[model samples]
Target: MKIQVLFFGITTDLVGSSTLELNIVDVATVADFKKSLKEKYHQLENLNSYAIAVNESYAADNLLLKESDVVAVIPPVSGG
Candidate 1:
């Protein structure tokens, strides 16, 4: 299935785009998507402090993903 992924802060810079299409396998969840992304983009491994939103609302890792859902990879704030 296809999902919309948004990158924020460092994630945007690392990904080089604020938004992109994420291709996911069958019966996937937020955690599953993250695993796939981590495999392809090792930088994601360093961003474990972010939150995942499903359809504009924050959700847990086990939250099931939908074809039309928008998944955002939000990096934690680190301004000091």
Candidate 2:
């Protein structure tokens, strides 16, 4: 299955792009996707704090990813 993964804030720097289409098999949950990302995109490991959005809204780690799902990594905001 193919899914779209998006990166925001500092996550864009680590993943080096705003988004990418990924081909994965049996991606049941966000945690599973995170593991794949940790291995394929090691830089993401350092970004422990990020929100995952399925299609557009924020979702839980146990949420499943569909073939046409759009997952975006939303990093927390920081400012004075």
Runs in model 1 deviating more than 4 A are: none
Residues 1-80 of candidate 2 have per-residue lDDT tens digits of 99988889888898888889998776569988888887998997787588888888889998888888988889888889
Error of 1 at 27 (Å): 0.5
- TM-score against native, each model: 0.90, 0.90
Candidate 1 global TM-score: 0.90
lDDT of 1 by residue, 1-80 (tens): 88889888899887788999987986998888888988988877777678888888998999989886889988888766
Off by over 4 Å in 2: none
RMSD of every candidate to native, in Å, equals 1.2, 1.2
